[model samples]
Target: MYKSNAFCRKILCGVAFAATVFSTPTFAANDYPNKPIRILVGASAGGGTDILARALAEKFSQALKQTVVVENRPGASQTIAADNTARANPDGYTLLAATNTNQAIAPHILKLSYDPLKDINAVGLIAKVPHVLVVGKNSPYKSVQDVVNAMKADPGKLTYGSSGIGSTQHIAGEAFNLATGAKATHVPYKGSSQAHADIISGEVSMMFDTTSSAMSQIRGGTLRPLAVLSPERSPELPDVPTLAESGIKGADMYTWYGLFVTGGTDPKIVELLNKTLNDALATPDIQQRLKSLGGEITPMSAADLAKLNKEEFERFGKLAKEANLQAQ
Candidate 1:
């Protein structure tokens, strides 16, 4: 009896030791982001992605007790920054301020230096911004149906510009084509700002762009809103009808913002990022700032993001093939 009790005590001690060994990393995350955290933005500054990246970085900095630096590596449908993050150290210092364009859409289209799903671990979703299909204020097409009619009438004459090829806006436009059975030739630009610029100057007829980038222009009479792609009209633009209301359905097509890091980063690190980001997202300043930009903050766990990413990739992949979109 004495020997059995001693063995039981030893076994309990060993189990406790094993538990501590496995659990220490999680308890250690409170000390994470001790160094300056690099938040990679896949687009140039001043665009929606950049704006949100900076906004969240500022909030994360204050909360995490570390400087959250926003780095721009814009190129190739914003895959440059995605690839950079994929290849970055797994130490939690480098993270991608990812968007649907770079995280979900571009991976399906752009031949990149890294793998979106395999090379990166999603931290969490930052926010969601609805898109507006807008045209020049002077354009004759006033509504979504009118644009579709014109496309059907001429097939490829009316052109729409995007931030770049394989971007969310680009794929959103193609998805619109898939829904409406009206194909529009896609013209790519360096960024949404330039795409909006071209639309303003009538260099491009229209674009499916983030509401934040096109809202002021639409309100100021520079661009005309054809439709809001949300299931309902946006609070900022309550007058615009949804694409579903205009005859397109089955695609929500909203622009999503997320944070990610190179895969193989400790799961503890990923959860730490999720906690920091979700906590920051719940704050009033970040919430209001993102809201004012027409973005809705959504804090999801890494596992949730992983599952959601697979769904989005499947969704866009199907649409891309259906639209015969050439992936590079």
Candidate 2:
């Protein structure tokens, strides 16, 4: 009887241990996101990146049934925010609204504290927006070809403004120069608003601005859409031709946004986040809202986004080397 009692106690203990071992992951998965989630953005309020972050945050909150907040760090060309997210706890509570400017371009041109490709795991691609080549309404140039011609006619005389030295706009301008042999002087601004102000005031010649950022000015008639820096024309500016259409091949530039967490995040958590984000993006409301902002909802799997992140990282590294781009 004593031996039987001892055996029964051991069996009970073993069963309990096995139950915990099997149930922990399931419990964690279901109980995740019990707290608020924060998404870090590296741009000031009212900027294109900030706008996208906020919009997504709201949808994420709705889908996850928890509060989603966007915290703006707004400096260091977005590396500040990227680094913060990279160092955050490897839980699903913290995320970063990763952009090509921070993930791809800044790594190439800036001295980063963390590796964009290795330090973070991409949850999924959120959206992509094409850059629009625009000039002041009263400017003499009418099209991308016109600007290129001016640059060729008097190299280094024409000037272009960008959000910063290593921004997507800067890359577009430099890529344009490489493709069309135009030498336009570059002027970096603290933000796109300042750049747009200079362009409107005629202090700068042109800018390769995001469609969403340039939308107000374009509608206000302060900026004229010359050609989109995309392979295809934007629906928002149907009249504007593509750079390729203007004979500038291989100059297509689009800023892509992704969701990310620290690299060591559990695969199950990453899968859940990807599913939630992709589902939110698929909703009609999210689709319409992003479309209105000149963004194409291109929801991709986490694996695909990881592949893209690495490719862009390598591609921009090569570009930076060829252009001799240095951290400022």
Candidate 3:
């Protein structure tokens, strides 16, 4: 009778432990964000990604009634920040402000310490910004065809600038070469600002710059807009034609921004973050701010963001393979 009672006690203890273990996540999710939350950005503060991150952080803090912070890690094409986030505890506190460059493009070219799709759980998608093909204000190439004609005529004499090799801008330039059957020498810069300066001064022929990065110069009349590298024209630059409209096909591209937490995060926490993000995005002030920066607000569920990330990863992988792009 003593032995049987002891065995029964052991069984009961095991069940209680299991229940506690299983219920811990629910309890944590319910009391989530009790402490400060941090969003890691892969780019330096003041860049387009950082700007959006700060904006979203403000919204998240207000919605969750917690202190949310944007921390910039800024290297290896945003992978440093991503890897850090992936390795963080699966609580909802540490989040990654991810872009296509890190989530989709970098994995194809750079050796990464984390699996973007697997090591990180998608929280939600925030916005997308299309690349704008631009040239120096005083350039002779007036349009996409003019640039194509120049490239074909010189057979690699024309050169283009980008943030860096294996960057979205570089891939867009290479995609342009493949689609239009033109060749232009690629000149990679340390950052978009240097590339923009060079392009504006005619140091390079052109650049496929993100709309947010190029908008100020474009408005200042130092950089001339040629076409947008997206399926459709951007609302910010509605008068600008798409690459397809310019008779260039198979080269549509854009950079997207989203939120992510470490993999194995509880579904309840993910849902909470997703709802907060979508609600923040739906606000008028936030909408206007993001729009002014040339971003299209793209609120989506965590599952949908995951699906989109996978699709982008595969698509960019194919593009990288075809373009013979490798990190340099």
lDDT of the candidates, in the order given = 0.82, 0.86, 0.88
Q: Residues 11-99, candidate 2, lDDT per residue (tens digit)?
A: 99999999997777667767887899999877767677877788888888888889999998777677788899889887777898878
Q: Considering TM-score, where higher is better, how would the candidates rank from best to worst?
A: 3, 2, 1
Show the colliding residue pairs in model 3. Answer: none
lDDT of candidate 1 over 54-164, digit per residue (tens)? 888887888788888898877788888888888887778888887777767776667777878899888898888999899987788878878888899989888888878
Backbone clashes under 3 angstroms, per model: 1, 0, 0
**Residue 191 of model 3: what lDDT?**
53
Winner by lDDT: 3
RMSD after Cα superposition, model 1: 5.4
Regions of model 2 farther than 4 Å from truth: 1-29
Candidate 2's error at 266, in angstroms?
Answer: 2.7
Candidate 3 has a TM-score of 0.89
Stretch of 10 with least lDDT, candidate 2:
21-30
Worst 10 residues of 3 by lDDT: 188-197
